[model samples]
Target: MANYIHVPDEAPAVPKIDVTVDERDYRSGALKLIKELRPSWKPSEVKVKFFTDGITNKLLGCYVGAVMQDVVLVRIYGNKTELLVDRENEVKSFRVLHAHRCAPRLYCTFNNGLCYEFLQGTALEPEHIRSQPVFRLIARQLAKYHAIHAHNGWVPQSDLWLKMGKYFALIPKYLKDPEQNTRLSTEVPSPQCLREELVWLQQSLSVLGSPVVLCHNDLLCKNIIYNQGAGNVKFIDYEYAGYNYQAYDIGNHFNEFAGLNEVDYSHYPDRAFQLQWLSSYLEAYKEHKGQGSEVTDGEVEVLYVQVNRFALASHFFWGLWALIQAKFSTIDFDFLG
Candidate 1:
């Protein structure tokens, strides 16, 4: 894995508020941070709203008065998330994307969380992303996102395989709870089987020739915020953002078409739709690089194969992540199931 570097000293430092917010009593903690950010606002008047869209972290929107203007989002890291996420890399990714006008402004970091400006848009549902214009917007935005190579001379390389290895290391050999242990043994693949799959994925995908670029890594529907009025989309949550295979990012997104709550792989985009989507992405990506926008059938075909194969890696990646989450996360979700 490439060494993760902090944002260059030239880049402005993200302010550290020096206060840790308790997830259980986030109200008081969030209020203190908000008071520092919006000192003029009366504590009684500030509205602290909990956003339920996120699964990995607790998100709270704090603002004073109506219309939800000047809102600051406080994101409390999930329990034991540091074992999986590198906070330095996350903030670095956020700063890089924000510099490119591709992301919202990040306000500051706290002891156990971070605060950022709230994006005003509706979080897309599965059906919304499947429709025309919306899908195109997502593709173009993602293409632009992949175009960013702000680490100066550092050659773009993915930590996907390295992170997978780390997640596998962290995953307990067996669940502590006997009932869950029984379910883990019966329902989930044996760790040895999973290790074999990971090795297979690494061998299979390393040869696909997918360009290494900065990727969102997790592009599930809810991560996308679409502003119908502005006719644009912004991807939030940089927890998993990093240098990765371009195809893996797109393929992971395709996997997310099944929706998070009621996963159904049947909803994955058909070949025709993928071709169209990939075509849009290629054209935009090429145009961004100052290349002609015309795309060849062969070009699309090669990417299609790479992306689909990488989709398998995406599935395997998240499965391991979920198993680890099942062991440690306080959030009530059926991670093993």
Candidate 2:
């Protein structure tokens, strides 16, 4: 037998990318974007606070106390802005969950390849996440979100998913540990299994006959907020918002809950609590759509698989990205390790 083995490619060295903007430039660009968006607004009157060390993008706090009681949190990157306004566009798709949509949100791309979004409300910590009843509320909201929008044609047409797969393919080799990759890979069903499941899901989806609605793909705990006055949970960061599998939104939310550390999970106390939360969500969702008496156990099983696949895919995708960053000295081995 010819001795032939598949050897993974060596990690390629990445070149250094220059970062041109300093704190002053970031502040100036942010203020300018805000002023341009609202020409009548005075820069001196509004308080702009800077937030550094953001993992994804830079943030500049824009508080307008005179005009509105709420804050207009201006997210600033090198040359771009994400404006999150309050009490504007009513989220038309899901009626069960209360959400305020904003408009003319300035999204800008920076020279350093960063995107920014300006959102209102304070940053949420792990402790804050566990302290509130937002988990149940979010579950219900997502159920409603998924149920109302079935499949009317909108799906992610962006190249992001394809890029995501390319990134995932690099993780095992970049990590230099085939064993770890294998172990992580097994936690979710194989690609073959997913393809089969998707086939069935598509058939069922067509039979269900529902309109596809926009879904907020990134609904991590940080993206959700508790509005005390309105007594509802609001979702932020619509960057990843698009039409997707209804079950995907729910599964992603469940995964977000699962990703919480042990300290956070302790607050919920038992698997039953989680089940109850999921149940409440399903109930609300069914009520909003005016269909189905109960969420079947079979459906939950399918959702579980969907969630796992998404989680594994995410881990693999980010791992490769970290490797790319490491090659360029943008990230270090210690960070990847």
Top-scoring candidate (lDDT): 1
Error of 2 at 198 (Å): 16
Off by over 4 Å in 1: 1-10
lDDT of 2 by residue, 41-146 (tens): 6787776666553433455666556543434444433222122111111112212122223222323333343223443445454444434476666666666555
**Candidate 2 regions with alpha-carbon error over 4 angstroms:** 1-24, 64-70, 77-122, 127-132, 148-163, 169-214, 245-248, 258-270, 296-310, 324-337
Clashes of each: 0, 7
TM-score of each: 0.97, 0.58
Tens digit of lDDT per residue, candidate 1, span 1-337? 3546336465667899988999989888998998888899898998889988877899999988887988999999999999989998899989888878888888899999899989999999999988989999999999999887646657767889999999999877788989999999898888899899899999999998999988999999999999999999999998899988999999999999999999899999999999999999999999887788999999999999999999999999999899999999999888888
**Predictions in order: lDDT:** 0.90, 0.46
Clashing pairs in 2: 80-108, 81-106, 82-118, 140-281, 151-211, 151-212, 152-212
